[model samples]
Target: MRDKETRLKRRMEPALTPWSGTTEATDWSLPEDLLQQASRRLSILCVVAAVLWGIGLFIGNSFPPRFAGLNGHPYPWPGNLVGGLAITAAVAMWLYIRLGHARPATLDVGLAFLVVNAFAIGLLDEWAPREVRNRSVSWIAVVILTCAMIAPSTPRKTLFAALVAASMDPIGALIAHLRGVAVPAAAETFIQYWPNYAAAFLAVVPSQVLQRLGRQISRVRDAGSYQLVQRLGGGGMGEVWRAEHRLLARPAAVKIVRPEVLGAASESDVRLITQRFMREAQATAVLGSPHTINVYDFGVTKEGAFYYVMELLVGRDLVSLVRVFCPLPANRAVYLLRQACHSLAEAHSRNLVHRDIKPANIYVCRMGLDYDFIKVLDFGLVKFGDRASTRQNLMTADHVTSGTPAYMAPEIILGNVETDPRADVYALGCVAYWMLTGQLVFQAETPMKMFVEHLHGTPVPPSQRTELPIPRDLEAVVMRCLEKDPQKRPDAAELFQMSCQCKASVPWDHEAAREWWALHLSEFTRGLTLAMPAAPAVSSSPVTR
Candidate 1:
C-alpha cells in the first residue's frame, strides 16, 4: 500500500506542483469569482465615464460664447471628435463585458481601456485653452483611483499600471510642443502634472490593503487541522473546498454549510436542517466498508458554518464516465454494480437507506493500485429506517421532496412516509438500466411527469434497448429489483448474491480495468488525480423531487 501510494504521488507531481500554496503560486492563480467582480465594476465605470463625456461635449458645443472666457479659446473640432470616438469605444467595451461572453479576458481588456482612456484625457487637456489647462481637476487621477479600488491585484502590478497612465500627461505636453502649440515651461510643467503622479503612487495603498485582507480571510479558512486550499464548487446550501492536513500533508475535501443558509430559515427549520446535517456526518463516519466514502473529521467554524473533511478520491463519477465513454459492456457493468452493492449492503445492515442513488452520486475512482474502485458519496439525504416516519415528517415539513426525479422509486413518489431499503434497490435497478443502455428508464419533460412515469410506466428490458448482449440471469436480477411492490424487490444482500451468480463471456478484473483506463482516460486521470471535486463530492446536482 505504501509503495502504491508513493507511485501515485509521483505520477501526480507535475499537475499538483502549481497549486502547492507557495507565494509564486498565489501570484499566478486568479479565482473566477475575482475575475467576474472586476469585470462588472469596470463595465459600470465605463458607462458612467462615457455618459459624463457626452454631456460635457453637448454643453460646451451648444453654448460656446458663454464658456469662451472659461477656456480662453474655442473648443477644437479634433478634440470634439476624439471625445466622440472615446465614448463610442467605451460603450462598445461595456457591452462586451456586461454580456459576459469574454469573461476570462475581461481584466486584460479593461486594463487596456484604462490606459487608452488616460491618453485620450491627456489629449483633451492639451486642447483645453490656456486658462483651464492646469487649473482643472485631474480626471485621470479619478480614473486611476477607481480602477485600483475595483480590481484586486498585487501592489506591484497596480503600481506599474498607474505609472504608465500617469506618464501620459507629460507625454501629451511634449507632443503639444512638437506641434508648435504654446506649452508650459519646465517648472510650470512639473506643477501641472504632479497631482496625477501623486495619485498614481497613492493608488498602491488600496491595493496593498485589499491584498492583506484577502490573506487574512485565507488564514481564517482553517477547519480544525485542515486548511482549505481552493473552492472546488458550491450549491445553495454550502461549498466544498480542496484542503490539506496541516501536519500530515494529506490531501482531503471539505464540505461547509455556512450560517447564512441556516439564518434564512425559521428557528425550527434551522434545528431540523442542522440535525439532518449532523446525522449525515455521523452515519457516513461509522460505516466500515471500503466502498463508502471515508470521513476524517467534522466540526463547526467560528462563524457557525458546519464542515466535514473526507478522503479525496481521484476519478470521474458514473455520470461523466458514461457520458465520456459509451455504455459499459455486460461484464464491466456487472463488475461495477457488485461493488456498489457492497456499499449499500453495509448501509442497509445498519438500517440506513441512501435516498439519493443516482449516477452522479456514485464515483468510480483509482484507489492506490486499484482501478475501478467504487466510492458511494453524498449521504445528505440518507434516511434512518428505524425512525423513518418521524424523520420523514421533519424532512418534508418544508414541502421539499428528496432524491433525483429520474431515479425515484414508486413508493417515494406516492409519499409513502415509511420508505425502506427497497427504495434504494429500485434506484439501483435504474442505475443498472442506465449503465447497460446509456439512458434513463423513463423520459419525461418535468419532475411531475417523471413521477407519473415511475408510478405507472413499465420499463423496457436492457437487452431490448442495446445491441450488446446481456446475460439472461443478470437481466432477471435487475428486473426483480425494479419491481413496483417493495415486497417483490430483492434486498441489497440478495441482489449482490444474484449478481455474483450471473455469467458473462468475459470477466472484468484488475488488469482489464487498468488497460481500459490507460487507453481511454489517461489524460483525465492525471489532470484530476488531486482534484475529484465533481458532483456530490463538491457541487451537487439539483434534486428534482
Candidate 2:
C-alpha cells in the first residue's frame, strides 16, 4: 500500500517551466517631422505680420506721434517693418516648440536665432540716445528675448540651447567689464550674437553626441551576446578576442574594428567592414568542413561594434608549425596536404575561393592525433567573384593583391581581381613547394619583385632546392598546380582526389624507397647535411591554420 502511494505521488510531479522572451517596444524618432511643423507655423505668422505691419505703417504715418519721429529706425517705416517680422518670428518659434514635433536639431536652433534678433532690434531702438535715433524703453522686448534664448523646438534641443544661451550672458558681461564701462545694451548684443554662437555650437555638439552614441551602441551590441575573456591579437585591419556566447556558453573568437581602419561609426567604412565580416562568417559556415573553423554567428552590436562569433581553435597556426619543423617527412607532409585539399575541395564546391591561402591561415590540431584536425582560418579576404561589382561601394583596391605575394599566383599578380579556383590551386602549389623544400618557391627581398616573379618568372623545382628525390608523377602534379595559365591548372576538386591517392600510396612507397635509397645511397646521403639556413626541423606545426 505504501509503494502504491509513492508511485501515485511521483506521477503527480510537474515538469519545470522555461523562460520566454518579453520586452517593451520603443519607437524610432525622426527629425523631419519637427521641421515640417516649424515651417508651417512660421509661414502662418509671416503672412499675418506682413499684413498688420503694412496697415500700421500707413496709419502711424497719417497720424503723427505726439513724442517724436525716432522709433526703432532713423526712418520709422523701416523699423516698423523689421520689428514686425522679428515679432512674428518669436511667436512662430514658441508655437513650434509647444507643438512638440520630432525634427533635426538645426531647425530649432535656427528658430531661436530668429526670435533673439527681434529683441535685439527692439532694445537698440530703446537704448540709442535721441541723437542716435532711439525711441521708448520696451518692457516687452526683455520678456521675448529671455523666452527666445531659452525656448527650442524639442526637449533635447531646448535644454542644450538654453544652456548655450545662458552661457552667452556671462560672456557678454565679461566683455562689458573688460572694456571699463557698462554697455547698458550688452544683453541686446548677446541676443543678436546668440545665433552665431548657436550655429558654432551645433557643429560641435553632433560629434560629441555621436561619440556618446557610439559608446552606447557598443554596450547594447555586447549585451547578452558574448563576453570577451581576453584579447587575442590585432593586425592591419582589427583585433580579435577570445569570447563566450551567453546562451550556448560555447567558446568563440570575436573580431573588433580597429581605430586605424575606421573613423567613429562611419556608415561607409562600417558597411564595408560588415560585408567582409559577414563574408568570413558565410564562407566558413557554408564550408562546414571539420578542417575549416566553424562560424557560430556574426553581426554589429548596438554600439557600432562589429564582431563575428566563431568556434575557438586551440591549435597553433601552421606558420609556427612549419618554422619549428623545416621539411616534414614525405609521408606526413602528404597526409597533411591531403587533409587541406579535402577542405579546399569543399570550399570550391560551394563556389567560394580562399584567395588568401597561406601558412597562417591553416591550423593543425594535435589534441587528437588519430583524428588530426586541420582547420582553416581568416576567409576574411575571400574573392567574392561577380558579387563585388554589384556593391554600390568598392572601398579599396586591395583585393587584387590580398594574399602573401610569395604564395600568390601569376594571374593574381597581373591585377586579375576576377580570380577563380585556379588561382587557389596555384597557391596550393606554392604551399606544397614550401612544405617539400622548407623554403619559399620564389625568393625575393621585396613584395613587388616577388609579385613580378610570380607573373613572369619560373620557380625552381622543390627537389632541386631540398635534395629530395622527385618522383616524375609528383613533379607533374605540382607543376600542373603552378601552371602560369589558370586554365592549365587542375581544379581543387581534382587535386584533392589526387592528394588522397598520393597519401594512400605512401605506405607502399616506404618499402620500395628503402631499396631505392640503397641503390642511390650516395645521392640520398647528400640530403642529410643539406645547407639549411632558415630551415626548421619537420614541425608538426600546421601552416594553413
Which parts of model 1 have CA positions greater than 4 angstroms off?
A: 1-220, 259-265, 388-393, 523-545
| Tens-digit lDDT track of model 2 for 90-112 | 56654654576334443555546
Total residue pair clashes for candidate 1: 0
What shift in Å separates residue 170 of candidate 1 from its native position after superposition?
Answer: 28
Number of the top-ranking candidate, with TM-score as the measure: 1
Q: Identify the runs in model 2 with alpha carbons over 4 angstroms from their true place.
A: 1-224, 247-249, 263-267, 367-371, 385-400, 467-472, 503-545
Give the lDDT of residue 293 in candidate 2: 78
Per-residue error (Å), model 1, residue 253 = 1.0
Clashes of each: 0, 22
Candidate 1 — which pairs collide?
none
For every candidate, C-alpha RMSD to the true structure in Å: 14.7, 16.5
